[model samples]
Target: MKLNKFWATAVMASAAFCGVASAQQGYPKQPIRLVVPYGAGGPTDAVARIVGQAMSTELGTPIIVENKAGGASSIGTNYVVRAQPDGYTLLVVAANLVLNPATGIETPYDALRDLKPIAALANMPILVAVNPKVPAKDLGSLIEWIRAQPESVPYASPGAGTLTQSWGEMLAQKYKLKLTHVPYKGSAEASRAALAGDVPLLFDLGGVTAALIAQGKLQGIVTPGAARAPGLPNLPTARESGFKDVDAESFLGLVGPANLPQDIAAKLNAAANTALKNPRVIESIRSLGLTPTGGTAEAFGSFLSDELKRWTAVAKSTGIRPAQ
Candidate 1:
């Protein structure tokens, strides 16, 4: 009877432990690290900080925003892809997550396969920006001028594998323009080049160059979205600017190492959705010239896959093959 009782007690203890483990599986028992794979003050960093702060409140723990910028976001992205699949480490992936892989570059990690998307955070519209010295006042004049003197006009982008670079290439191919490609170390540098008139065009996210346009230091010819930016509703979209199919925007999202627990991912996605819905956070994100979007992991995953296929075709058509 003593032995039987002891065995029953062991079984009960195991069941109790299993219940505790199951309860713990609900997620976010500790602080989480949100890694922004870009320099501080960049668009990705700005969005990550805002979302991270609001999510911290919803999760009942501090969500730290860590800037890990370098190698076209590869260094930081690879760091997170290699992190433990636990919910502790998360990444703020940008459109470059898809563009980089399509560029045939030696990225440290594969975005679609190595990381499981948690939620989409925001979308930064791409703008056709130029310094005031460009002389083209609007999209039509700019197109005419570029068509007349394609090779003479040079454009700047954050890097070769970035969305800006991809857009510039696509624009060149679509319009049969001969714009020179000038890749900068980062978006800030590329925007500065446009501001200084070193580059005549900027095919980059509006968040990087919107202030210059507002201050009249730069001009916006078009944006690569179906609709004008809410911040600049007066500007026309690329489709309206005469290129009916030139719709593209830099999408931002959160992801973690692949194979993350479904329950943990669900909790994180809930917190992110809550964060994006915060009024103050929404205002901040819009002020940066982004449209906020927080949705299911499945939605984000599908979006990523579509982007990969779309940009891969873009790269192939633009002759952007992997460097030997």
Candidate 2:
């Protein structure tokens, strides 16, 4: 009886090994869902769809996109963080995934602790645009103008506790510009307000504001990035605009619930990287005023960590928090 039991246990171990190998060999046996933590047609969703399409071709499986927008992305992000660690459900999230918890109120999931970052898909700068009627032609003039009328001028953002508002707050403290903040439901509304001259200044994603600047509806002052964007070659960066320690850029990427299986993460990473290399995908990103950035899961994880640390300091210094 003892000999029979030992043989049975050995067979079970062998079967388990084979099962794991088989599972990895033909991974993603079904559709993969890529969740975006914002509404459809936004920059995050646009990139998610492009990358999802590329992944479908590379992985020989359907890649589905799901948008869950609200709570400044916490509602959707929390859903993915609590999802099964099978890698089937993924998130295409903006910088808010890291920024909100670090700078805003309580967050449902710890970005670094509850999510496994898959890749850094892109880094997008925010544009500092003003209504054409604003008495500022460029960065220097804008600074002077802001300095002159500290209390009267106000800036609009996608919402309170968002990157847009955070930049506004940081600018106010860094430059001592004392501009009031007007939060809108989203970038579209904020941009509209700026266009209508309701708000003289706005900090919004470059992709959304680039067209307006090109059309002469708004004037671009400086981009919140380490350097000028390729599409907006004439625009200066925050550093160049004489603002020290205020370089900010929004990155969009893919992340899954913490403890996702190693093999599954590897499979998705490979598929995503392959998709990123496609010429059409590259063109699409450039058209949206974004540069395609793709890399290993570890790199994105570190980027998120560094951003959280950086923004936490900004939030503390600027005294920014959710509206009462």
Candidate 3:
């Protein structure tokens, strides 16, 4: 009886070990879903499809890019947050994940506590642009023109609590300008508003607005980044435009539900870094006006934390509250 019991224990342990090994080796045996928490054709969706295709090649599995946009991106974000932590369902979201909660909007999931960071995908500067009807030609002139308006000048953003809005608020505060917030459903809508002159000023991802700026419908004022954006080399950065404190950028990254297996996370991170290094992938991302950022899972987590804290402080200073 004692020998039989020992054999049983050994068999169970061996089976468990084999299961783990098999899981690690056969990860993503089926299709992987990459959920984009924004509308299709937007920067986040574009990055998702780009990285998804690259990761599919590396992982030998199909990665389906799904758009689950709405509710300031909380709807799709919560979907991923509540998903299984099996590495199959992942989220590719923009900086709105941090900016949403930082601005006091109640989300269904706690970003830091409920999600495991997989990798930082890319970063894009926010381009400040104005409608052709606006008299501003540069950041300084825009500020002065805004000041001259009898009422608060309206500025359009992708959404109310997005990083674009935060950057708009930062600019307003830095220059002590009276600006009213105009929220749109997505980048397309916001861009339309700016082009139609519904709002004189707009803040959007640099990649999405670069073409419009070139089309002469909108004037590129400044980019809120530490340096000039690669896509808009002629546009000065906020710092260069004399607003050093107005540095803001939108970053996209991958994450899974909390408690994702370490080996799986490592594998995904490695694949992402490899994809970012691909010459084609690099060029594709750069063409979209995004700088590829492939780093360890830990680094992505730290970046998210820092962004949350930074944006939270900005919210407080700007007196931004959750939209009713």
Candidate 4:
């Protein structure tokens, strides 16, 4: 009787191990939901759909894209944070994930604690632009014009707790420019505001502004990074304008809820990387003025950690906060 009991326990243990292994081996037994924490037709949503479609083919399953925009992106973000760790639900968001935590934007879940980085999808160089009616034609003139204003000039950013906001504040502080921040829900809305001259100046994603600038609806001032953006070669770099210290750029990446099974995370990361490699997917992403960036799960996580640290320091120095 004792021997039979021991054998029964051993069999059960083996069966459990096999069950887990089988599940991981045959992952994505169902459709995967890719959540965007912003409105549809926005850069975040666009990237999610393009990459999600390609990943669907790689994983042999449909990748459903869903937008849960609101609360400064807290709504959809929290939705993924609370999802099951079975890898069915995921998130594709921007650098705001780190910005929210670093700038104390009051998110429902902490990104580093509640999410797992799967893979980086792309990098978007942030640009400073103004309405065509604005008197400034270049970065220097814009700075000069802002300083000469009698009152604080209004500038628009994607939202509070974003790199654009921090960068805008940094510029105001560095140059003593009297600039008032006007935060919007996302890049798409902010661009529209800038287009309608509701906001004279804007710090927005290059991907969203390239066409606007090309059509002469908006005037591009400077692209803040190490170099000029390829899509907007006519636009000078911050370094050219002598504002080389501002190296702000937006990042887009994929993430899942924390404690997700390691195997599932690896599978998703592989699929994302593979999807990013496809030629059509590459062209689609670039057409939006975003650079395709794909790497290991570990590398993406490290990037997030670095970004979190960097944004924290910026927030401390600038006293930046989300708009009430």
Better of 1 and 2 by TM-score: 2
Window of ten residues with lowest summed lDDT in model 2: 98-107
Task: Give the C-alpha miss distance for residue 200 in model 4, angstroms.
Answer: 4.1
> Would you estimate the TM-scores of all the predictions?
0.87, 0.89, 0.87, 0.85
Residue-level error in angstroms, candidate 3, position 41: 3.0
**Alpha-carbon RMSD to native, per candidate:** 4.0, 2.6, 2.9, 3.0
Question: TM-score: which candidate is best?
Answer: 2
Over 1-324, each residue of candidate 3 has an lDDT whose tens digit, in order, gives 999999999999999989987887789789999999888987789888998999999999999999999887899999999888888899997787888889888887897999999999998888889988788878888888988889999988877777888878877777788999998876789999999888888898775577798667789999878667766778898788787677888899999989788899999999999999998999998888888989999999998999999889879999776556
What are the per-residue Cα lDDT tens digits for candidate 2 across 282-314? 888877888788999888888888988877887
Say which prediction, candidate 3 or candidate 4, comes out ahead on TM-score.
3
Candidate 2: where are CA atoms >4 Å away? Answer: 1-18, 150-152, 240-244
- Give the alpha carbon lDDT tens digit for every residue of 1-324 in model 4: 999999999999999989988988899899999999988997789999999999999999999999999877789999999999889999997877888888887877887889999999988888899998889988889998888888899999878877888888888877778899899977789999999989899998775677888778899999887666657889988888877777777889999999789999999999999999999999998888888899999999998999899888878988887677
lDDT of 1 at 236: 84
Q: How far out, in Å, is residue 134 in model 4?
A: 5.3
